[model samples]
Target: MNWKIGLADNWRRLHTKGTVVLSGGLALVTAFGPAIIDAWNSMPPDLKALLPQGIQRYAALGAFLLILVVRYLAVRRKGGGDGAA
Candidate 1:
């Protein structure tokens, strides 16, 4: 198949799994948002200092993006729709 067809096929096969993962993540954040913020607020200064300045705010977003990038790379390396289902 052409690359475009293969890409579309891969996306169709992967879309449900991606949706579930993203939905679950959103649910967890919604359930824990308050407690998570409280924990972050209560973190000791020394421990908080271990992270780079200004990183605390973006850490979750960065981690989520990193997971996506890694998954995409792994899928590409596996030849996407060419791989066995």
Candidate 2:
């Protein structure tokens, strides 16, 4: 009944679910990659210009990484930082 054990179990459950979701998402992106690229290419130049040249892709990557870090921290904090599970 230790809290750390409870947190470990919770984290394991969340990790399994996250893995499944990530796998499905990656498959979907792969399936749509070509079409997505075509649509982006067909987008209007002005619309694309909303983001500064050469930085949009990096910005998106940074945002995704930030989200991942936030999720990690939240889970770690809930688990009391004992490196459980």
TM-score of each: 0.47, 0.45
Q: What C-alpha RMSD separates each model from the true structure?
A: 7.4, 9.5
**Angstrom error at residue 17, model 1:** 0.7
* Tens-digit per-residue lDDT, 1-85, candidate 2: 6554345456656644544465466567668879987988999999988967777477557656755765565333455666765
The local distance difference test score of each candidate is: 0.68, 0.65
Query: In candidate 1, what are the lDDT values of residues 1-85, reduced to their tens digit?
Result: 6554345445656655644466577678769989988998999999998988888558668767865765565333345575744
Evaluated at residue 15, the lDDT of candidate 2 is: 46
Best by TM-score: 1
| Residue pairs with backbone overlap in model 1 | none
Query: Which candidate number would show the highest lDDT if scored against the true structure?
Result: 1
